[model samples]
Target: MALIDFSFYSSIYSYNHLFLTVLSFLVSALIFLASMRKSKLKRVNLPPGPAGWPIVGNLFQFARSGKPFFKYVEDLRPIYGPIFTLKMGTRTMVILSDAKLVHEALIERGSIFSTRPRENPTRNIFSCNKFTVNAAVYGPVWRSLRRNLVQNMLSSSRIKEFQHVRDKAMDTLINRLKAEAKANDGVVWVLKNARFAVFCILLAMCFGIDMDDETNEKMDQVMKLVLITLDPRIDDYLPILSPFFSKQRKRALEVRKEQIDFMVPFFEKRRKMLQNPESDKTAISFSYLDTLFDLKVEGRKSGPSNEELVSLCSEFINGGTDTTATGIEWGVAQLITNPHVQAKLYDEIKQTVGDRAVAEKDIDRMPYLRAVVKELLRKHPPTYFSLTHAVSEPTTLAGYDIPTDVNVEIYLQAIGEDPKLWRNPEKFNPERFISGGEDADITGVKGVKMMPFGVGRRICPGLGMGTVHIQLMLARMVQEFEWSAYPPNSKIDLTEKLEFTVVMKNSLKAMVKPRA
Candidate 1:
């Protein structure tokens, strides 16, 4: 009986061990099968891209080279061809290097291209709130708000009416610039001061006050925060750490609060003031706050929620501020680098203005002057690439089946520099915009070639206003001073680095010899 019991126990243990081993193998086999199926399913007919290692995609590409890593993609355009594909971690992006393809994707198929919203790190304070015009989804609300903004704030007639406000602001800028030149002996903090002054003017016009010290500092901090957050990274493409790391998220919320602290009170004050029948209409001409409040005051328009109101107000100041200053700086950088371009520009301004302030109307007449500005924009668009337009739905492009929820990033930088479109692509030639000639008509946002304010339905609504501001300001600044590169290099370096916007790797520093 003892011998039988021992054999029975040994047999039972052996069976159990064998059963366990079988179960484990089966589980492993199932996992492998499942993973392989997913790999095949996800591998739709997409364009080929550079081979990336498992887990990390082009982070190594960025580390090996440039700040705007898009430059690397620009480099690859010749080899892989223009419409190459990229896989940054899990994120798949299609780059449109050719101008015709860009227009096909963005302009011709506007509805398809318009769905991609601006992504994380750059979504700013207005991201969550959908009521604000820019953040709203592609729908009725967006159409309504965009129309209102154009008609009320950005129309040519409305812009013409606000000529004085723009003029007064420019005058303030010139006076302050002159003071800085005298005080610093021409080594002024031009970048910071130009940024601040432009911010102050735009903020005041929008909200009736220059942002407070606390608020201004907060805005400055947000600018720095955005630069770090907007870094082109594989992790950002995949969003694996999005939940764990909320550094960018926290910064966005904090920035919004600071903006609200300054904007809300001003919005409220304007609303109350406009309610009065005897309010000063003269001071209210084309002002931002007035338009928002006008709707409520007249009871003809439905006003946005107080939060929405403040968000809109904040974006107005934020969008307009950096853009105007950046445009000026970019033009200066271009002019300094291309002395021949500068001389022609100076001569055009000299003949048009004759020591008078360059008026808005003067800009319309000066075609060569217009060409210089156009070329500068083509060369260095402030925002080289805005957030890749998200493919909210499945779409077809170039016969490729673009999956839903993918991003289609049309590279404005590449498109502008495409050899097929612009000859001698590296050369800075303003005369390329001359009409009735070889590949001309680089005239306006509506033109086929270049788009600084972006393109298609998502084009910047404030483009017209922004264009006028840039032209008038550039005309005046060049007309007012004979600018020369300080420390006298043969020419300006014209190198670029992409921050939140593409800025000169070297700050646009120059000797401001007065044009007597």
Candidate 2:
């Protein structure tokens, strides 16, 4: 009787399994059909952007050259009419060339239009992993890391303490420029030196190492290794080529391993030194590494593991280098092009600092220099798109659906130079920033205008520190030296080639003659 009962139940169970399987497939089929129908009806809702070739989707179509982002986007505006849709690989990017749209999307409704950078190989590297600023998605971990940076690296108190660092770096930068200044018209790549200074100083703040020539060289090599590994190789975009495209991945692993080997020993050495109470005083004074080891400042108890440490150190650099340096370089280029503005800036600096070395304390007093920086920032922001991010909430813009996890960008470069926002958009004028006569702060103009530091929640946190360095270095250098092009305008090449960041096609080689 027991065996007969078991058989009867087993038979019923088999039928039930079959019935469930059939029902599931039928429901799935209905869902699939409904999705297909919905997809077929849906249309891309954006202003007329450039129509791209089918699959590649405007792969390399952007400002191929200089800070004429207005001109670059204007080429499309005539056709697409201010708002336009563009594609980067399979992803869609809406370019808001108009300032109002930028404000509407990126500022007022920023929760729906915040940060995501999915382009290139970041997705592969960090999607499965949880240890980076670049790859961490828009969520708690990002907020945590960002908050930590604010408290430890970029806070007002920290910056006040680091004023000496900037002052020293400024003195060093000026001394170097004066030393490098030639009697004859010897062309120097001013941008190259500026990039090195920005990275070197920021690295010092990040790792707590005072940058000397040898240390700077070592830092440069590490940064170079990182950049080579980050270049956007096309093979990774397509699936079939993925296996063959493992070379970059392999190279990155090897590079990362090398980075770890370099940083781990250094970290341990610092850690041991920090263990000593005497070292704690000198140690906290020594570098950012020791500061992390001491108290649980910034929520993180200690520096990341060897690999993570190196990546974070590298992250401390990332855009902070290329972007600021590029902006400053463009500032120099613009000043060089428009000597009238250059004379005005030099006059202001001379009136304020008066042949004496620009004391770091005096920087806040120099409004025109502040204006020059802000105006340049307004004109030539490096990233046409703010570091891209996906929308985490259902949002609407221009009556279009911004579905959750959909990617978006704030085209600050486009928005900052919009004719409607500025009195004279195309002209390079610094007076636009001097609102309170000569005593106003120009670190950034919020809401009314988006400075290059970016706007709202995901704005560049390092703005104060970053801006000070550029102004101190570049302004001092320009004031202390007389820069002129390698070849006079008739023979000068004005071509521009923008790579990881923008560069003069021929490089900004100029004769650096000492003002004295």
| Candidate number achieving the greatest lDDT relative to the actual structure | 1
- Candidate 1 lDDT by residue in tens digits, 1-516: 000000000011112333333433443354544445555555576666776534334444543443345666667777777566775545667766677766777778778677644455535345434555556667776776677777777778877876776787778777877887788667554466567656656655675543465776666665445434434332244455467447656766766665566557766666665666357443453367776653432222566666677667756766677766776787877777777888898898888778788888888889888787777777776665644565556777777767765667666667677677778777778887786253433322344576677667777777777777777777777787767777666577677654445667787777676677
- Residue by residue across 1-516, what tens digits does model 2's lDDT show? 000000000011112334334433443454544445645655645544666433444433432322243345556667876566665434565555565565677668766666563544533442225454445666666676666667776777787777776666667666665556543335567777777667766666766644458867776787777665655544333232357567767887777666666666667766666566465443336455554443332346564555556656666766477777776677778787877877888888888888888777788898788788777766765644455555667666776666554455545555665656666677777776676232222222344355455555666667776677667876787787766666666244545554555445666666666776
TM-score for all predictions?
A: 0.82, 0.80
Best by TM-score: 1
Global lDDT of each model? 0.62, 0.59
Q: Report lDDT (Cα) of residue 36, candidate 1.
A: 51
Q: What is the lDDT of residue 497 in candidate 1?
A: 56
CA lDDT of 207 in candidate 1?
A: 59
